[model samples]
Target: MNFANRIRRAGIRVPPPARLVAGLALLALTGSLLLMLPGIGTARPLRLNEAVFTAVSALSVTGLTVIAPGRDLTVFGQIVLLALIQVGGVGFMVLAVLVYRLIGRQMSLEDRMALRDSLGLLSLTEIVVLTRRVFKVVLLIELIGAILLWLHWRTLLPLSEWDAMRYALFHAVSAFCNAGFDLFTGLPQFPDGVPNDGVTLTIFAILIVIGGLGIPVVADLINWPRSRTLSLHTRLTLFIVLWLNLTGALSMFVAETLTAGTLHAAPVGQRFGLSLFQVISARTAGFAGFPNLEALSPGAHLTLIGLMFVGSAPASMGGGITTGTFLVMLISMWSYVRGFPAARAMGRTISQETVRRAGAVLTVSLVVVITATYLIAISHSDIAFLEALFEVVSAFATCGLSLGITGDLTLFGQVVIMLVMFWGRLGALTIVAALAMPRRKTLVNYPDAQILIG
Candidate 1:
């Protein structure tokens, strides 16, 4: 038998969940090993915790880091890390499957099902086409983003042609992946004590918005003509994202303006730019123009924590409960308030199964964050409860903005955050589905009883 046939035969006995879990585990392991190579960084073999943490962060497309990227790692090392982020963000297996299809290789039924699950597609064939479209979409967006960024950077930095090209490419990939790794050490605040100008902040914001919007939504928008109406998924994502962006900007503007003594004083234009940048960065992109997280008011910090919890859209480069899940819960709440029998959105009733899944995702994500916060607190009591909670939520949402506590995290704290990042990226449900065994149903049906729920 051919390799595909042999794999098929083996899969006949192996459950789909096992295959999914095995695939993700294998990818994570391979990504970790590759990132650990000596060629990847100048730092001596990384501490076990550091290596694992970096691996998880990159694989999750989270920008959290214990070490500075440009200073800590050589060019070669940065490239390897970037590659991991790209694959992890797009999904390694999904890309591989797309490659096979492009070359005219027939995908086995098992493989199709696995791809469907991984990409969050409704059907196998549709997923195959969607995967191809996603690949094209990513390439187009990254290419255009890189060019625009390069044009903007060329005006700011006086550098050799090659160096400028490298910087542009690196930041472009990082921004597009929603991975907040920055070569510029001093952020929000410029290295030479210069303020972040409007142009740089605006470009970065656009990049973050594009990256955080999920691939499916991007695909739908790209093909909008045929389906003049946007899908519920797309509509909800846009609405939630706009609301959050505007609210976050306004909140930061007021908070920063009021506490101008705490944060560095800037002109009106620069202050607005800084506020917008920091707010967007907190949501999903960890890129910060300013390093003074301690300067923000307690209210701003709390506001950031809330935004991180909401996170980016589903199947996007960023992570969180996902806008879709959040919207579903909102609709469910609205229905209850209106005395409706079912949760509805955009004139369509959400299936009971979808509502249940959203509830499960939210519940599990909250539990993970709370448990991690408590654990971190036990290990590092010096850190305030709210700070610990913020850090945990940042990890769980894959939003890497820290309260200036990353490098100071205890080894135990690092491990806890690493687990959160892993869980966030793989998703609570995906992990649960992977762990669950296949079930066989019997012919007999048991009577159902209603339980009181508050």
Candidate 2:
């Protein structure tokens, strides 16, 4: 408090968005330092890049990894990583606010505004109540998931009760946070992930979907008085999620079946599960089940890219332009094709400004992904164009799924991925909005431009 007060007295005004960004950075840096501790590693010393990368990945809730975390980090380190995931996944702001409220600290107006922004709440009036609800929702779901996962592991895999429970808790948080992290890397039967196991995949997939569904949608669903009373946002989000997952899974199922070296030999049921899991994980969950990514057909590659690019819904743990924004732009374009002056959905009229903003986000995301891809491709000439594109999209979407190229990138390429991960996690526009504070106070409106283009 004194530190903040001193900074305030020094005539330096720090905006909430900027402060939020700073707080996340501080957390990452602290986690990185902790990861560097000698006890965190097993005999071998932790590399600078490894430590920093893991910290960023954990804090961003992006599961991209250059090394096997289970093999590299000790149990203590894993716990630290878990803490970062929970804080990052639930959001640092909400956790901080929760702590403050627990200690009976009065949330100031600035704090309230930050909470409102962090949670994507409509107003500040009910933010406190909403925060309390979020704490309950996160804890309850994770707890239940852990218990169920432990039971499943004991029944399916050969593991002791203690070990199973430990793995269960770790994965439960990872799955719920949409972190895509798994501790099965060095566990013998599961080298990469539990690819062939339908039971485990089902549990992970459920957690991923629930986590990818934004907090606003979750809260709305939980609090809705009736089915008919659902908000348009909730309805649109649910519809898009269902539509995207169905189409994405079906596309992968077909593509993989057609591809000779892929899931063709697997049983029909297993094939279906793998396809469904991939599509679900592709939308920012970062888990890769069955038949190695490199073995997949070219068509499947393109499909995965599209899913990663569109990502999950906004105000969610996952990144991308968000399902809502992507669909709004698509619907708006279709509306324009029919000569409608404005975009409309579910009997509600969309404002021109909203349409424009969606377009802007989509445009900026494309530019960032393309530019990063080009840079990485040129520097790492050995890497194929498609692979480069996949890495960039995964990083920019904060989706950790990869074609096994993450560890092979040059220092420059790794830095590019890191920057993209940072920007994608916080959001491209959000960084701009945070750093470039608006100062114009003009009441007079300028005439709109009449430029035309195809």
Candidate 3:
């Protein structure tokens, strides 16, 4: 067989979860090398560690970085960064399927299964059609966002026409993808951050919200206006998303106002905008309305940590246990408290399997954050416990909102954070499944073992 056929055969033998891990790893490696090539850097080429970390962060669509993209990299490098974010956000499998179709090669059964797993879809039916439509929607949204951003920034920022257009497009993709990378961070004019005017923040907030909504929800919502109906999953996602943002915003505003922190002495209107923007950014967007995060009170920090841990929805550009998983867990707890036979939400019963999966994800995610935090705390003596915890949670959730400690981390600590980001991006359950060995089914049954009560 030819090289391509041989490679395909080998890939087919791997489990879907393992295939996904391998694909992202390979892409990150290639991106790392590309980022180190001549003319990519602003002054000197990136070091091995810098390149690897940047590649992983961008490919995972997590915004944490050791080096500043705007100040340290050339325009070419920024373009490369953008490319990685796009591929990572849209999913490499989707692009692979697209390429296969373009080459007129039919996807094998194995390929279809891998694609289905990547998209987190329950069924394999119409997977190809759905993939095509998803790509179209993603492109359309990004295109529109870029155009609007260009118009908004044309007169606001001091830049030539070409640079203005470039910044607009770059920020548009970064915002819509929930990647959190920003060119404005490197600009001297905006030391803390660019202006957080209501108009700019609103545009970004809308994109972030849409991007964080899972692919299935987005597709479903497209037809909802005509159908005047919604699925249980979509309803739960929407309700939780709305509730979280509102409550988060309110809590943040109260905390900051009481502590006289970031919002101190600011106009009521501006305070409201900053509060909502920060809460929305906490949901995996990572853009900073108030860039001096350390200035926020402990209460505000705690609130942000909670929101980051929750993250965004499943199969979204962002990461977390997902809104669906979080909602199911909440309902499950309520059902148990009420002595109900099954967990229910919005007048529909949730399956036991989904509840179990949510619990597993939450348990594993907690362990990951706790363990990483302990390791980081020991490695960096100067860092505070709360800050370490926050950083670990941010990495684990792929939220990318740091308390300005990313640059101060040791090499070992940085590696741990990178691993957490990778784990967070693929998800705790997916990684567990990928690492777990296959087992054969058995018809045998045994009596349940008795256990002590809590």
Better candidate number, 1 or 3, judged by TM-score: 3
Output the lDDT of residue 388, model 2. 94
Best by TM-score: 3
Pairs in steric clash, model 2? none
Q: What is the descending TM-score order?
A: 3, 2, 1
lDDT of 3 by residue, 2-67 (tens): 654797768746778888898899999999999999998998999988998888888878889899
- Badly placed stretches (over 4 Å) of model 1 are 1-8, 11-20, 102-104, 186-195, 259-269, 442-454
List, in order, the clash count of every candidate structure. 6, 0, 0
TM-score of 1: 0.91
What is the per-residue lDDT of model 1 for residues 374-430, given as tens digits with 9 covering 90 to 100? 999999979988788888999988888888788889888888998898888878888
Per-residue lDDT of model 2, residues 1-454, tens digit only: 6787788789787777787788888998998898899889876767888888888888888898877777777888889889988988888888877788789987877767766776666677777787788779988999989998998888677778887898899988898888887777656666556534777778888888998988888888878855547788889989999998889988988897877548888887777778888999889788887647888899989998999999888878888888978889988988989898789888889899888878888998999999999999989989999999998998888889888899998778888888888878887657767988578888998988998887
Show where candidate 2 strays beyond 4 Å: 187-189, 225-228, 443-449
What clash pairs does model 1 have? 40-77, 187-289, 187-290, 188-289, 188-290, 189-289
User: Regarding lDDT, does 1 or 3 come out ahead?
Assistant: 3
Cα lDDT for residue 156, candidate 3:
89
lDDT of model 2 at position 447 = 86
